[model samples]
Target: MSRLIQDAYTLAKERYAGLGVDTDQALATLDQISLSLHCWQGDDVAGFENPDAELSGGIAATGNYSGKARNADELRRDLDLAYRLIPGTHRLNLHAIYAETGDQKIVRNELQPEHFASWIDWAKANHHGLDFNPTCFSHPLSASGFTLSSPDPAIRQFWIDHCIGCRQIGASFGRALDTPCVTNIWIPDGFKDTPADRAAPRRRLKESLDQILAVPIDRQYNLDAVESKLFGLGAESYTAGSHEFYLGYTASRNDVLLCLDAGHFHPTEMISDKISAALLFVPAVVLHISRPVRWDSDHVVTLTDEVQAILHEIIAGGNLDRVHIGLDFFDASINRIAAWVIGARNVMRAALLALLEPTDRLRSFETAGDYTARLAFQEELKGMPWAAVWDQFCVQQEVPIGIRFLDEVKQYETRELSKRA
Candidate 1:
């Protein structure tokens, strides 16, 4: 056996010993281990997968919204669809609103008490099996230009009111769903150019976060503060920037946690070690998994071999369980469903690789009391190409290749086009 395979065998033996399993059971367990079962959904997948398709497309296509009904169904069908796509065992990150203007901004006009209530009902019915995270508001109003720093209080209050309104909506959703509605706060609130005032904008964000947490809600919600490096307000200028700034800001606040985006960290710094360390402080409630190419961060769920190794090492060192995995992709060109399916596949492979580490090896590294273990682990992973591992595992499990999945999506698109014709 190769070193990696030997390591896997050793870990299996240890697990079997803990379970008091005989050699026969250990071998059987090893044989049954597959790589397609370890992934979870990120909210961005819904938006990225189908820009035109409402959240309902990812959830279910069976509901309707008539003109200004007081009781709107925010996500009943979508929630059902989300439930179907992800088994109850996995976490589902639901986007509250797609970041858009005019007709696309569904939350501004339609997400009323009745719609909120329907979401709550759907969540409560399905909570026993599935874990749900209702990411807080994301729309033009929620962005930097529209928040507390705005010259007009009405505009700022509109943002605040939206937060307050969403809290009420979230409370209903959580009550009906029986799961905590995670407050995902990602503000494109920084200056596009050199800020006329740097500290002021950050202070505004802090105030907003503090105010939101103070509101009375039924269940405990985590404020997942997303860190990005891109300086500025508009989507075009906002590049994924430094996470340390966001992490430092939220760490002091109660009920607040960091929502680490893998690609976001790639631009500012090498994230593996920094991320490992961050987990030591704040609880990471959610993860945005993607790869960064050049300066632009592509939401391709494709993992480089080095990244897979680092992620595995981080998990083996004990950060995996703290956060829910989100298969985040935001590419406009790719088919959204294909992105979700393919991204989920890559995430599963990453998880299996992480889980395959031997407990003793992990413990020994932890006991060493030095940070060098991260480096050593990276060295161990140096020779192993994750692409090869992914390919081999796909073949072994009889799962479709990424290219095949993409082609399937293309065919679906073609059929849809024909129907339109």
Candidate 2:
């Protein structure tokens, strides 16, 4: 099977070379793109701090999939297994709720880097990086359906402090791992019904964000981002942190990155179209790639056209270095490890497809007003032997190729996950 993968790649290389595409260079470039895998997928966003609490803040993970990680140790173990199946090295995105504290009751505001010391050590040993977030939902303070934009000053201050703490913890991860950590803030602050005073809430939110980001962290060890959502389970009528809100805020600050979630928009909207425009104002951006079924439903990612288009934008924008790619989805119906493996591999597959394209050729045709040739070449790329190159990449990365990975997933499910209960 190894020899077969190599032989197929050899033939694919020649075919791609005829079109001025270098498969070898594409593979090398793909190897350097590190995806930040969301840790919530392993455990349904119910972290170790208080696992049994009902998911609040409009966040819900449906289905009773077996083997959900119950504690930090188990979650880390599952991530280790999932990483084995994925081809390139990646980072872990952690939320404040995942903090580990034995018996001591430290609230979110008082949380410290020591709480995540184990995570940093693990990342350092494994040669991985870590990103972070402030878990503004699923807590007592957020029961009012507002966090940073809460009417209560005390509640807003609590969330503000929590976000500041998360930024510090993210810095610790970067210092320990020697890679900058992007600490993003996403709060569920909106109204279910129409609000008479919409402007007041946004004004409050803007002020709250100002306080939260007052401190300047070094860019080498920490970066900041603001995430916005169109709506959530409860916040149907008005989401204070809309796309326009964050875009303007990020543009004004010039130091923060705007986070764009694929599902956090109108059904008709696409992030691929926004990436280019956003990059013009902000120096960089953080992408939360998710699949929306009917609403802001976090379904496991598939290799759909949206996924390919998003990758194409990242590569073609000539700003791949300024973008941070992260996966944001959770499916409680299927094997959780397979969910991670499938999402990560499909992202890499899409990236490889984008890379294998002689985009320069398409660009030249478009620049020369050869629109017909551009369309013809794009349609032809669909039939290229890119899968062979993908298989060889997996082979080189020492991961199983094709559906052979499913067999390993099944074995691990039976062997390790079944024993969890």
Candidate 3:
């Protein structure tokens, strides 16, 4: 067991013993925490803008590509900045330009496919971990932002070709880096205005995926199907208006896994328990960690009591092993640097708390529950208030603000270094 898990178990035992609970529940809970930590691994999609600069109104309002470089030299500078800004302990899910450019619908669309070779070379040379989402092209192809049942075969074919190319590039990159490339395939491929079109798109999407999976690739990849809210389409218009359609489809495919985005579940008002249960069957390879603010999802992590309780239950349920906890932030109206910091802190706090929870007791609880007994049972979480625990964990983790600043400084330094070199 990791030292973190061991320490958490000790703390839980000491605390629960004082509560007069001696049924071994506390020890079991601690063991669960240990198991979770043992299986812990995470990564996030890249291109997280800095929150401070974004909020300060530094970025362009048009949402054009002006901040980062498009060439090899520019990429090197950015990679160096990422290392300096993000702490060494934190692993990034570097978004391939394919996904970013596809999402932004840049006029040239030249950053991704055209530049894929160089990006892979850069990652291998620099030793940066990669997290790629190959199907971001579907976002624009969908007329309603998620309807895969479009009659336009031309548009569909375009996306299909793009996905195929992306997979080929990803496979090569993974082999070069000797790292498992996480292929997160999320589509805004649902219906927008009609419920009738929902089933067809989902079916077609599965067909499309089937074709891609048939392609020969050597890299060990996971098809992370991200479930998100129904946009452009009415809530009730889609398949039961939930993400289960996508999940069920991906689960049927070989070597494909689900990428659970915490914010995506917000629209359905599904709590952590529902998420835990839904994903228990399919291993979760990556997690997009963020807080949800009312209707606007993916807010900064605020260490709320509700959030802690939800996360604790999920960790106790045994899905943390396939986790790649990555930062996902988009604040159209705030400083980009501040946004990055907030997103990073959110991920850090959640991870630390997850590491602190007891594991043994949780497993026992899972087994101890008779259908009736378990239904009536309530979990006894022993610790300081969640906020206090969060604070303590942050202190323990020792994540410094300087780490966030490092990326910016590194960007400048890299630029100068390249200029001189």
Candidate 4:
């Protein structure tokens, strides 16, 4: 560890101690929380399913960043670089579109564990877990802006079969790694213009989801989740799987979780305010942390007030045990590895800051109806030496601390990323 970082952490530790916050405990808590790094970021959401396939489903990565992963090996290599810069280890989130089909024409419904054997081996070797997602876009069937909720039964059945296959893959990951893999289902089914009947699509969606979850899967190996979106590129008018739909679906079904994507809501909505309410009825919840500019841009995440509030709410509401935290964003505007490292580091930093908060005292003040002291003490904590403790954490984890970390990213970009054809 660096002596300078340790010395600064010592002073910061003493300062936090006066407020009854234990730096060691906070760091320990941060270490326990694993943020699943989204794999699409490294490749700008361009999966290897079809090298010539263009992005669809109202999704887009806005930059022609150099060295985007062209294959599974390159993606893993880039992820390796990202993990080196991040403190501690975390899980990887994968989409079904990234399956390795080799020269064979393996349809989504026909995908199997063998397609992801390399990923399983790599993750096992790296001591990381895996999460899976069903890709419901960029296919000919979904070009009409509907999949599971399509009026055509044949088209809807195809997606259902694909989702079923994805569940099996997710279970295989969990069985191999001995960690429950969360298989999430998110579809871009909606209308660009006002629909004559919104209820029909939603009803069809509910039926489709029921059919998808009808097959019994062991909870020990796989957990199911549903994600919702307010709107999308062409579907700016209506989204079938709205937040209310998934909330009601998950609440009614004891077996699945509701995934709350921070960027999937309206600009005025805060995911932090919804955690407690969701946890009250749903068995568990999953979070797709991201930054939304004026809309669902999927911008890179930073340690903003909303992010901090999300972490703080999870910690304060005692929802940590029931919430699965994962990052979901793709910014092709910067070094992909650097983007991954920055987002993951910011998440960890927010968690650390939340952990360092004196929640019990604040709660007691709230309980006693002392709102004045509660606000004052909360504001006072804003001046805490969080950066020093974070630097010390990076030192302990044997990663580059502060600006030093960017040097490695630059070096890798010059040596490796720039050489990509």
Candidate 5:
């Protein structure tokens, strides 16, 4: 209840009301949209299963900022702080490699719901939802640079079983938490150099996907999703699961969702423009929001033009209800907790900006062939007092009202993260 915050919010509310916009309604809408924060950011994608395992899926987390979480407990502790810094209640996205097996030797294929019992319990206790992903990379089984689509039947079977187990775990999360968990499958099955034949591998990918999804989990418990990529670190030749592949697969089966990752496309191509067209055919989509510089770098997300456009498409296209939004960036170059806070907060800001827009008025102007006014209104929205309302939101959510949250993170760093070194 700082005087400055209150005065700014009151002025912002008045300014928005003049544009036929209800700031209150916008904040309400923003509150309802929950973000699924990725767990990998806490530990630079090095899970508890084997802290030494290298990221093999053309995936990498740059930087060696001290205090990377070494185990599930530490990671959860870090995540607790991060969620508290964020404004809304959000879910945690876990990878198969993060399983806590204590001193036992367990492989991906043999993973069970019991292994993730602690996570389920944590989610329940904290009122947070949980999501799952199968670790198809960073294993001896994937040393050949192919998985699921590998011509070797044994490797394909291994990955298939792993995915089946992950889906079941996702269902367990949903059943336990009463929130349908989205189990998404993304693989690094491709050749570093151009391959002689591409058709055979893709056929194998489709078949493997079918076998993995054969059993029907109650949509109420878990939903299936497939992610695609144009290229990868070693898979520059061709990514088996290209955008077209998953788009067609998910479209063919309404049961599965198509995952459109922001950093998975060409530098010039944007996922924002594809959301509208993809939703026309696919029932729903899982959005893995990220920032890419020249390639799929998986940089921290910011309130850039592309990010804003992505949010606008979701808010304006009326696709908000069908899209599952999750962040997908890992920057180990800075404080891990700060990385999470920056990416998540920037995304929420973009979404809040989108929510505050006068979309109806802009649409009507466009429909009436009033291009000049449409563009003018769109430009004017850029200068609106949205940040004031956002500050108010952070205040209401009881999180940090400004960069003051960073002070808390640094305190934690000095009190805890610094000791890890």
Candidate 6:
């Protein structure tokens, strides 16, 4: 480690000590939190099977960034590069569409664990835990923006079968790695124009989900989750699987999780408040951390106020262990590797910042009705030398500090990513 970084950390540690915060404990807690890196970012949500397929269901990658992975090998290579730049071990979240079928045209319903055998092998080799998602978008069946909620029984059955298969695959992944794989199901079932029969579609969706969950897999290997969206590309008027619907569904069930995407709610509604509320009823919670500009744009996550607030609530609520953290954003405008590094590092940074706070002191002040002292201490804590501690963490992790990681990314682009053409 550099002498300057070491000296800065010592001073910062002393400052935090005065606030009744233990720097070492904070760092240890930060190290234990693993943010699952989304695999779709490297390829702009364009999976390996079909290159010509266009993104649908409000899913879009804006930039025509160069160096996108053409195949699974290339994608894994880029992910390894990004993973190296990131500190600590993490999990990789994958969609079912990313499966390698080779010459076979295996339908989603017919998908088997063998299709993801390569991913399991790769994850095992790299010490990375894996998470799974059922891709209900960017497919022909979903072009209508309805999958599980379709009025046609055949169409609904097809999607139900696909989700059932995805759950088994998730269980296989968890069993292979000995860690529970969160199998999340997100569908683009909604209407661009307001529907007169919203009730019908929601009823069908409930039936479809009931059938999907009929086949129970062991929870030891896999946990089921349903994701909700406010609105999207074609489905702007109404989303069948709205937050209320999923919240109610999760509350009724014991095995499922309610996924709260930051970008999936109204602009004014912050998910930081919802975390505690949802966990109160549901068995647990799953988070898809992303930044939304005006809507559900799925922009790359930054260490914004909302992000910090979300982490703070999770820690303060004492539900960190019950909540699963995953990143869900795709930005094709910049270096994909850099996007991963920046987002993952920001999450870690936010966790560290939250950890460094004297939560007990603030809570005690609030309980004692000292609002003035509580507000002052909270505002003043922001000025602490948190950055120095973060930099020191980078030094300890043996990863690049600050802007240095970007230099390494540029080098990789020249020697590796540029040659994709």
Computed on alpha carbons, the lDDT of every model, listed in order, comes to 0.46, 0.92, 0.46, 0.93, 0.92, 0.92
| Candidate 5 residue pairs in backbone clash | none
> After TM-score superposition, what is the CA distance of residue 120 in candidate 2 from its true location, in Å?
0.7
For each predicted model, how many residue pairs clash, with residues at least 3 apart or on different chains? 16, 0, 43, 0, 0, 1
Residue 317 C-alpha lDDT in model 3: 56
Candidate 2 residue lDDT tens string, 1-421: 8888889999999999999999999999999999999999999999988898999887989888799898988898899989999999999999999998889988999999999989988888888899999999999999999999998999999998999888989888888899999999999889999999988889999999999889778889999999999999899999999999999999997789999999999999999999999999997999999899878888989999999999999997777799999999988998999999999999999999999999889999999999999999899899999999999899889998898888988898888888877
Residue-wise C-alpha lDDT for candidate 6, range 1-421, written one tens digit per residue: 4999989999999999999999989888887888899999999999976877988888899997789998999999999989888877899999998999999989889999999999999999999999999988888888777899998888888999999999999999999999999999999999989799989999999999998898979999999999999988888899999999999999999999999999999999999989998998999999999999989888888999999999998887788899999999999999999999999999888888889999999999999999999999999988999999999888878899998999999999999899997
Q: Compute each candidate's TM-score over C-alphas.
A: 0.65, 0.99, 0.64, 0.99, 0.99, 0.99
1 or 5: which has the higher TM-score? 5
Local error of candidate 2 at residue 6 (angstroms): 1.3
The true-structure Cα RMSD of candidate 5 reads 0.8
Q: Report model 5's TM-score to 2 decimal places.
A: 0.99
Model 1 has an lDDT value of 0.46
Query: Worst lDDT window (10 residues) for model 6?
Result: 48-57
Query: Clashing residue pairs, candidate 6?
Result: 58-233
RMSD of each: 8.6, 0.8, 8.5, 0.9, 0.8, 0.9
Clashes in predicted model 5: 0
Off by over 4 Å in 1: 1-88, 98-110, 116-146, 218-228, 232-245, 266-268, 306-310, 362-421
User: CA lDDT of 156 in candidate 4?
Assistant: 98
lDDT of 5 by residue, 11-90 (tens): 99999998889998998889888889999999999898888977887889999999999888889899999999999889
Least accurate 10 contiguous residues by lDDT in model 2: 412-421
